[model samples]
Target: MITDMTQGNPTKTIIKFAFPFLVGNLFQQLYNIVDSVVVGRFIGTDALAAVGSSFMIMNFFSFVIIGLCMGSSAVYSFFFGKKDYVSLRKSVFISFFSIGIFTIVLSILIILNTNNMLLLIKTPQSILEGSQDYLEIIFGGLIFVFLFNACSALIRSVGDSKTPLYFLILSAAINIVLDLVFVVEFNMNVEGVAIATVIAQAVSSILCFIYAFIKIPLIRLHREDMVFDREISTMVAKYSILTSLQQSIMTFGMVCVQGIVNTFGPDTIAAFTAAGKIDSIAYLPVQDFGNAFSTYIAQNKGAKNNERIHEGVKSAARTIIVFCLVLSTLIFINSENLMRIFVKANESNVINLGVEYLTIISVFYMLIGFLFMFYGYFRGIGALNISLVLTVISLGTRVLMAYVLSSIPTLGQRGIWWSVPLGWALADSVGLIIYKRLK
Candidate 1:
């Protein structure tokens, strides 16, 4: 199950490793996408709007955990490539304890202030109670989120991407079934979807943990492995905190934009939500490919295979460009139909708004594609700060442009749509320049 990236053609190896990641992430996105569809169709527009808006907040916290796990996974890949089992074991121990504690503290704070947090985001009064209830239930599953991400990261670090995919497929199926049961059959509404998500997350986390302990010897910890080494801890903190900050900042920017979207009322919110999910699913292949590329680069870097790393950069670029172009064309052509899947066909206003957003954003998928490649490359090379800087540039531009352009009488919400690609173009430019200099 463990494939070595240090051997084989750069393109083939990276693609093979990345395919499972792409599939797994799709299933993962289904957790949110299914929630939105179920609520929007069965419940009502306001319910859909509440779930959609709440997603911005939930995504922020979820990315924090993802970033931490991703950062630590880079460390694991490096150690594994170096064949330093001792250091790998130590890192596994350090990251698990450190991120675990952080998740607990964060969950407590967020749960305690759920209502206040919703108010701060300027959630509309009509959807405020629903958002609060949804978030509160979702937050209760943070530990499960932490556990699942941590275990999967450790497993994938050693090049076993397929194992994680298996678990995610199972969990996603469970989530879909539960969503129907709770929301449609039992009529639990927004709260029903929230509970289903948490339960699904718990199932995946528990199964992933058991698999890691039984199957991945490198992840198994002895009592002696639990002892903290200051050196390893510092390295772990550097990768985890910086990556977490980068991810949190990026999502925080979305949270700000969500506040702006909230001002436009429930229709816009519902449309934006559906469009955003489709956008995420559309571009996810490239994103997951970037992550897989990172692991490939990390392992090569660890093995001192600089030549392979360089080759990988080129291979990844070509793959991303082709994939993004094809995906963009598909989404642009099918925007309206995709929207109808989430919103009712009779809800022409919501579908049309979502279609407009998609058409505007789809053509620029390559820009974000290139940006993700740069992010993965930087993270792989331990240039965590560079990744963080690129994120700030992209998301900062997004938040700023979104506010300024949207305020224009002529531009309005279209400005928000236009701002996304502008941010992507800016970040891609900077990333390409930096990579050139580094080369």
Candidate 2:
């Protein structure tokens, strides 16, 4: 199922890869979305808020793993494009073991300090215990999250996006079923959904690891390949650490914003949670397409197909603009209805707030779309520092503006909403200028 993007029409090949990746990303998002829905509908607003708040923290850690894996996969794709099988296998061994140890250490630290982390985020007392319980259970699955993302990244590096999608579909289905069984039948509350998510993640991670070893000969590590080379290790560290920092910093800013949102109490917290899920789902296609474009560019870069990479940038930009326009219209029109999905119709205040957040941000999807493309492009070309700089600009603006604008009495929470697109716009403008200069 491995594809060579260096040889195809850039637009067609990128879309072909992105379609499955987009679906897989959707299923991946479902792991969290279903948890919120089940907890919200079955438990209560407090429980929903608890899960939502804890999610921002959890997302911070999970994205660290994702960024590391994604960064390493660029190296994998480069080697694959060059037919450097020996070095590729060695990298697999190095990245797997190195990141695996890091995940273990991180899991223990996060688990032990769960309460303090929540407190630092200004988690209100009313939902503190629920958030702690949810987070503790979720932290136990960090290794699984690392494993699944690592395997998926490696698989996708060689253009086998469909394989990972299959596993995600299976796992997402299991997560939905388990969410119902545990929350509705057992009435386990927030803890129930958290446990369901962990179990589902375990399924996906274990299955993916097994599939990669048995089916992808390129990825299978032999005894000799297990020995690390200093050069490869250095390369992996440079790419992985920079990318991980970028991803974590981006989420960390959200955690900071979540702290601000926490100040508004549980209603705003719940509304933000629901609205955030809708926003992610709405823009996920363009985001995943950006990821696909990264893989395409990485392969072409390895093969020294500079002209094709330029064509891909143009092709991806056009596709993203059209897609964003359609998505913006759909989300803007159905904002209220989407809010109602995660919250009850009776919760008028929560629904209205969520609608407000969506209406303001949904119209600006193209800005984030371009930003994602730039992140992908820079990372693909081994410009990890550029990606990090762009993320800092984008997220730093968001966090600082969210605090400053939200503090003004007139702007209030609406200020927080508007700050997002403003950050995206600034980042996109900078990214476009940098890319042009690179060209």
Candidate 3:
């Protein structure tokens, strides 16, 4: 289904598109959210800490795949909009196989050194083996994760968001069932959770691929459409490499931040783990909105609908602001209730510290809302270099300030929470200035 998003009511189109995207993101995150809840309640905070500790490392690799998908989607959406089916087919061929090969190689390399990777992150001794168990299974299934992500993004890029949402609902449902069976019935421990995730991803990727080839005429490749185009490949690589670098920088900084959090003792680890889970849920809608905005902008840009892009983005900003204000406020007021969902009842220190962390971070939701929109706009229009610079600024400030403030005798772990808002403030301000300057 090739949708020309260039001609609709901009606000209604974005709203219609972003709603399914948001639902898909929620289903997508069920993988992590379920993993955290199951680990915390059934296996204890040590196991939850293990999963949380390894999360950023997992995200760094996910960054590589997502970056390429984002880059390819921007180009392909433009092609789809302009009815350039030949080049669109070529982009599809290259993106699918190239990402598949890269992820396979990356999985092998990471699987070979999973233990050492955990050690490098200063994974606490109590949770080290659990982390190792989780990372190995996930890395081994990297091909499925990478492929599913790319395929889903491709589907949405052409304005087929509901299809992916359906695929994800089935996938998330399977993962939840398998999580219970593996963890409780089979007694695979933490390894079970990872295996469940991998299996679910494999199923989703296969189904999604089958559906696309059979159902979407645009995805079907003809013999003439299979040739490699060096010029297009170069353009995609240019956007993807810089985009990947931008995300890699941010995740790498989080790994460093994770390492720093490890030094603050197991209490901090448990609290941060719980807080991180809440943060993921809270941020998901905005992230989904940003992704939709990117595709919307790219499709319109391809049609030379500059004024439409501007009008749509303005409406989106208003919606996102309302969303942010409402969510942050709810989280702030009920921060303790939410913390209790992940941290066990006996861990009062973890609950208190989790509240502190969430309370501090939720206050800056408005900044993050703006930052995501700007990132999407830049990525969609091929202004990826600016996006890259903004990411570096955000991550650099976060890591530096975390170490600086946390080292203070008075601040202790509290400073780490404070550093988040401050870093977000700086990055959002920079992103706004950049957005204003963009023509």
TM-score of 3: 0.97
Could you tell me which 10 consecutive residues in candidate 1 have the lowest summed lDDT?
Answer: 215-224
Tens-place lDDT digits, model 1, residues 175-285: 999999999999897999999999999999999999998877766888888878999899899999999999999999999999988888899999999999999999999
- In model 3, the clashing pairs are none
Residue-wise lDDT of candidate 3 within 1-439, one digit each (tens)? 4556788887788778888888987888877788888888887878888888888888888887777777888888878877787888888888777877888888899989988888897989998988888989988888887777788878888888888888889989999999989887887778999999999989998888888778888778888777779987877677667877877887898888998899987788878878987897898888878888888898888888899888877987998889999999999999999988877788899999999999889988988788788888888888989888888888888889999999999998888888777777888888888787875
How do the predictions measure up, each by TM-score? 0.99, 0.99, 0.97
Candidate 1's C-alpha runs over 4 A off are none
**What are the per-residue Cα lDDT tens digits for candidate 2 across 1-439?**
9999898788999999999999999998987799889888899899999998899999999999888999899999989888798998999999999999999999999999999999999999999999999999999999999999999999999999999999999999999999999989988979888898899999999999999999998788899999879999998999899999999999999999999999999999999999999999999999899889889988989899899999999999999999999999999999999999999889999999999999999999999999999998998898989999899999999999999999999999999998999899898888989999999
Candidate 2: worst-modelled 10 consecutive residues by lDDT? 31-40
What are the lDDT scores of the predictions, listed in order? 0.93, 0.93, 0.84
lDDT of 2: 0.93
Report how far off residue 438 is in candidate 2 (Å). 1.1
